[model samples]
Target: MSDKPNDLQKIRSVADYQFGKGVGEKLFPGGVKIVHSKRTGRIRHVYLEEKRLATLRPTNGLFSLNIAGAKRIMKHVKPQRLWVRVREEAEPFVARGKSVFAKHVIDADEEIRPQEEVTVTNEKGKVLAVGRAMLSGKEMKAFKRGVAVRVRRGVAEEVKKETLTLV
Candidate 1:
């Protein structure tokens, strides 16, 4: 019983350290469910009822943000974590479900590393997609070719569901 609460606290702490302040609270609201693996009993998924928010990587034990989690965190935190900002010209394409190109990236969080999960946004900070970073932030700004973010999910109407239902 005590272990469960402690585990949840550790998860929240990790989210705060990884993303930013207030992000954990936003993503893991009260009543959020932490799904554990059947074999290992380790947290495998974080969910708000039926909406999956993130997955805990078994190799590194780090949380990888899903589309729903990205959207939730984007609403609370500024674009300073693992975030990439693209030009308005790229908004339509990104929102329409396309990978972000380095040529279109106007700015990005300097802390972003290659292969890390990131959220792509427009100039005004509208989240367009959640994806994995293909290049470092410096590389994304310096290079004109190559993919910056390999979009895992896009901001289509189907993706933007309403408030998460508590489990």
Candidate 2:
């Protein structure tokens, strides 16, 4: 929290494991702030320049990405992992914080597993929302009913941050 090197290393290592290799450094560059839980005094939220980036889940010990964090991944995480590209008809709704249905998914990373963090993108690679995948990537493509991703934050909710992005 106080520009601690250990904190940075821990978060970066977690990011690499959760997203992919080299993602921790990119997602959380220098100067980012780590906020500890008031009740637990444990690292809880991560921020950069006053904007929240991600939250460390206490139950799973995994990072739940904010829109800002998702943008960083889209920009720096090469070859794209854990992405769910949805249909045109669903883009608007997804951008408004709606869950992505299996029938609407155009394509998804086959390696994605259930309960993992995922970014919902448009056809042109625009990040629309960030969420936990309710189904595996293969299931999203194969199934026609049920939810694929339960969106946490949508781009529409953070229109001001839209310009600060990695499309």
Listing every candidate in turn, what is its Cα RMSD in Å to the true structure after a full C-alpha superposition?
A: 4.1, 4.5
Candidate 2 lDDT by residue in tens digits, 104-163: 999999999999999999999999999999999999999999999999999997884556
Which pairs of residues collide in candidate 1? Answer: none
Candidate 2 Cα lDDT to native: 0.93
TM-score of 1: 0.80
Per-residue CA lDDT of model 1 for 1-167, tens digit only, reads: 44456666867877887777767777788878889999999889988877888888899877888777888887766645888999988887887678999999999888888988899988888778888899998999998999999987777733444423222
Instruction: Write down the TM-score of every candidate.
Output: 0.80, 0.90
Q: Model 2 clash tally?
A: 0
User: lDDT of all the models against the reference?
Assistant: 0.82, 0.93
Worst 10 residues of 2 by lDDT: 158-167
TM-score of 2: 0.90
